[model samples]
Target: MSSTLLEVTRAAHEEVERLERIIVKDLQNEPATNKDRLFQSHRVRNMIETIMSTTHKLVEIYEDKDSARKDEIAALGGQTATGTNVFSAFYDRLKEIREYHRRHPAARVVDANEEHEALLKEEPVIEFTGEEAFGKYLDMHELYNQFINSKFGVPIEYSAYLDVFSQPHSIPRKLKLTRQYREYMENLLEHLIYFFQRTEPLQDLDRIFSKVTAEFEEQWENDNVQGWEKDVKESGQLPPQHTVIDLDYYSTVEELMEVGPDKLKEALVALGLKSGGTLQQRAERLFLTKDTPLEKLDKKHFAKRSHGSEQNGGAPALKEVDNSKEIALMEAKMKKLCDLLSETIVQTKENVVKKQALTYDEMEAEREEEEMQADTESDDEEQQIYNPLKLPMGWDGKPIPYWLYKLHGLGQEFKCEICGNYSYWGRRAFERHFKEWRHQHGMRCLGIPNTKNFNEITSIEEAKELWKKIQERQGLNKWRPDLEEEYEDREGNIYNKKTYTDLQRQGLI
Candidate 1:
């Protein structure tokens, strides 16, 4: 009896997964002194990888030839072996791509319908009604009131529409409250996904996340974890702090900010001020509130969640909206995309976030890629010899020219204080980094505007002084209505507002 092709494929896939796992988990790390085993894992892994690659290549070539032959036959008005219509199938597949994009508007379909110019030129049909599209906008007027109300004991911090979006399977079916004790920051991340997507902050965040991922992976490699992704969650907790930020302890807000955004935010939270903003904003908020009476500090920031009724005996405010199925379906797709984004935050053991395939078909294709190829690449990298100096890799996967590296001053490292002391390799990278997201982000946190005037001013103190001087100069130049503007009196005498008022009061006009 012969096994079906699908059954054979499934068996082969399972065997591949098992073999790869054993090679990685069992044999890969055997000590070099184990002469009995002779450390044959590398050789065994390489040999298996070669066989897999060759087999897959041969199979692909055969399939390609077979498909081309059938296409040729169909194009020449002949029948295919399996009675398949290749020409029709090709266009049908293209149409399927078009239809998929139409159904899932937010899936980020790129190079879409670009297989043919005529199809690409065709405008996509707009399905959402004008009223529906208009209605979809967030009602800020009502939303702020809901936030102020903090309805259903949900803390306002994690109650935003976008925050609700990223938590998975949260649309169309119906909304449900978990009511589990989360300190408004149940998750490590407190900001919106949009904030995390910002370049500078993302880079800053990447460092924090990279450290966390490394530690988790090390634990996983040691067989301390049962599943791969159970620990892929954010802590949202601030970095550890030593002391309370105080006016007596620190002379300037710049001095107070030496503790970093984490500490600054903690101080802001303690002071009952808005804790969200760049590092600079938090420090400023803390310093400004230092002299204020405790009662004057924002109470809204720490407002307790209300149940069915507000403490004032007012019922929770509601914004009534009539939803159409089309709008609901659109929202469902959007919610699914958001859910998938949070679901697919896997790290590749390197510090990089693994790029997720955007569509189901692409994801299926990615899953089908041979696992051995990755192992083979890793093995090949280990076996190859390289430069002793450990220079940067070039576009062709070799150490870049030593002179080119020297010319660019790549050997030297520059650290930007504004960028949380993130180091940039080479003078070009260092200079360029000042203008990039990380440095600019650091500046933004300090409440300093990123401009040429502040360029190369990485010292927080210097930035504060320059910002103060700029503000002073701006104030001097600013038009004062009472002093600067001249008013013509009935006697044809031009007088400033103060002079004109004095003359009118004295009856001297």
Candidate 2:
């Protein structure tokens, strides 16, 4: 239909242009005789006026049709006539309505019998004019202002109607200044304001919304905490205490119980526990301890005398008591320190549990548990000697081998020459030994930095080379200022040569 209208408009335009050309040509070709030229000129002017009137009418008609089409498309909830497939458009709308109904089933029914029944009372009709009309517009503006302010908890002005009024097409063709026309304009303005509000971008609104939401959330949390405390008091139950380690172990145990003995055995074996004997035995070995009374155990008794008397093979003598007050004070201080540490641990555990509750997800929980279990198993296996060449078939039908142990020469007797001839076997045992305080002390004794990278350099030659490279990189052989040059007048104050010289030249120095 639009295409047909466009074709008719094109034809009308062409006809108008043709008439204009003909009128121009006639005026140009007129005879030079005064009377004939005058008559022909008058005729050409009349033709030109008629063509102009016709073109204006055609344009008006085209504009009216275009506006009507735009209205029709808008009424049908379509953006463009050419782009809209009637069937598909209606189908999508229907689907959307169906989905809305599915989500909120109550909106499917319309209640028109009781509450929405025709009211016996007639609504008041108020007319505004002059100042009163202007006052009513102010009232409407105030209402819009209040609506935005109250809804968003922020002040926002409605100026979209101003733009609508500025548009030429917004005014009807047969516009009037009557009461009905004024009412129509008011309604149109109201609609425009609503449309703008509904379609406005929320980028500017985010900060205000976030602040309001945060305040509400904080209040909600406070309320929840109060309610929880109340419930706890009413129930006469203590609040639960939870730690990160406790939660992890609890989850692991729960999963193991759910998966049964077969999986439990597998988990234990993976943890480097002997998988021999029954599943019950493996479970006991992993989770239980032997019950023994203190009285039943073989205990060693120490004499109340000093060992020096025993070594001299002499009769035990009583030692003189000294510094009893100082000893008592030290003991009290130690006790207070222990108490503080325990309190700190409890608070830290509570904080961790609270944080975990906020961010925890069930899927992520499972994945974390798996990773933790793998790490635990790896740590356990890393302490034991294992042959990487003989790989065991994993539960997943893949080869589960200690490849790192073989690669790092951990299965054999390993020694770090830089660490002063210490032999280590097993992956973790060797790595840990290499990174120990004693090993670091040994490296320091050798006048080298105790970096972990040196642990990989097992041979003396490689260690020497690494130490030499480190020394060169650190510029240990570079020229440096003496103590006097580094520190001028101030005791225990060190500086670069230039800074020291500058300070020394100053009168204060």
Candidate 3:
């Protein structure tokens, strides 16, 4: 009985030693966060407590058995041995084991001073407050509203528009302008023009206004139009409409050149001229002489001019043409581009705000549901239950403490056969989790040392192959002088072979 008790105690001690080795190794190698260190410390403490309790019980049992045996020997007329108690040796061993643990504490369960230092090193989480979030949202909303109304001459209701924007599918659907509001504005413009025509003395006012409206409509059509109405109407099948440039306005080459390269290119391209060469080359080719007729210049003529220029080994020197009209046209185009860019920026900001508002709304709904569920649970006595292991939900509806996913192998896309088929979502997570404790444990269970490439192995066969290579390297290292040599000076400082050789050559050691 005494022998059996001793065996049990020894086995427990061995198990405790194994756990301690694992904990110490993890502490040395793993770059754990404060929370992770705390968890490891608690686990070690629990295991230690259980070992201590079991050893005490075993000692008690051994003492009782020893006492009974001594009594039986005395009753049988045999001289009772007065030597040292058998349980005393076990007690001494237990004390020594306890002392060893006391001297070498569990991983991250450091002395008070060390714990204080660790606490100081920990970073606090910064949470975004409701008031700050709402304030930012309101500011962005006002700016976006002002930009749209000022630029497009349309007013949007903030609350109503935000409701549509907050929908999860709204952004992908490309919800930009409201259809009813657009049609209303178009009709209003027409009504205003009619009213002005009846009230004013100008006879051709309506015709002038209609022409201006047509130009604006043409511009809108040519621009990259967003929203469902434009998409459903165009269907990406129709070719882009060309801008009609009345050639009658520009009677001379000088007047044509004043419109700038872009407008000049557009006019030439529309007129079926050869669309080759640089803007300057094309312009020079088309207007070779001041009296050259625009109708007379064709693709063949332009091609011939290009071939002639190439044969002559260089482009013909064209005269620099600059005018006030060209400068004015460039300025106008720049201003239009600026307006389009600003509108795009404003729309992008609006999308960001929509996303934020959607997240905020979802969080609020979740909070309310939790509160209601708590109330119902409180009303029921037997039915009320709590799960301490369940993690809290984040604002995005994911589990709080994101590392929990790694532990349970949840939300992962790839599974590794070597690590008990644990899943990893991305390459980063897969690589990072390989160095983690859970993965290392799996390797140990398979009787394989967790090498640098252990985490990278996807199958048991791969692990075995790597282990074989590692053993070969170890065997080679045993015979290698480079692996065995370590230099130490009189001050007991250790150095590698290269460093020691250099130091000795320099007489520094």
Q: How well does each candidate superpose onto the true structure, as a TM-score?
A: 0.23, 0.17, 0.25
Looking at candidate 2, what is the lDDT of residue 411? 47
lDDT of 3 by residue, 1-509 (tens): 12334455566666566555644544464435534444444444444556677667666755776575445434344333665455655675577767777876763433644543453344323222342231122222533354346422235555445333222122221111234333433333343333332222223554654564465456445643222123322111111222224444556556655667776665454433565666566555545422445434443744355446548764441210122222222223323322323443355457556656776436544555575467556756565344333544657443344344345554447788867887776566788877888788888888997777665687888888888888898885475555457889999999878788888999998
Residue 12 accuracy (lDDT) in model 3: 66
Give the better candidate number (1 or 2) by TM-score. Answer: 1
lDDT of 2 at 192: 35
Q: Rank the candidates by lDDT, best first.
A: 1, 3, 2
Regions of candidate 2 where Cα sits further than 4 Å from its true position? 1-411, 476-509
Clashing pairs in 2: none
Q: How many angstroms is residue 122 displaced in model 3 relative to the true structure, after the best TM-score fit?
A: 64
Of candidate 3, the 10-residue stretch with the lowest lDDT total is 317-326
lDDT of 1 by residue, 1-509 (tens): 01223334455565565445544444444544422132243334443665586558546644766575345435444345667565775776567667877877888534423433332223322222332221122212233344334322244432243344333332211111112212222221332233233211213444544564565457545645221212211221122121245466777878978889987775665433577878877777777655655455555543253222246453332210122222232333333333434422221111121222245444433433333244345756655634556778878666665656667899898777777777889978877777788877888799988998987777788889999999999996898989978989887889999999898899988
Off by over 4 Å in 3: 1-267, 271-353, 356-414, 424-447, 450-458, 479-509
Cα lDDT listed for each candidate:
0.49, 0.45, 0.49
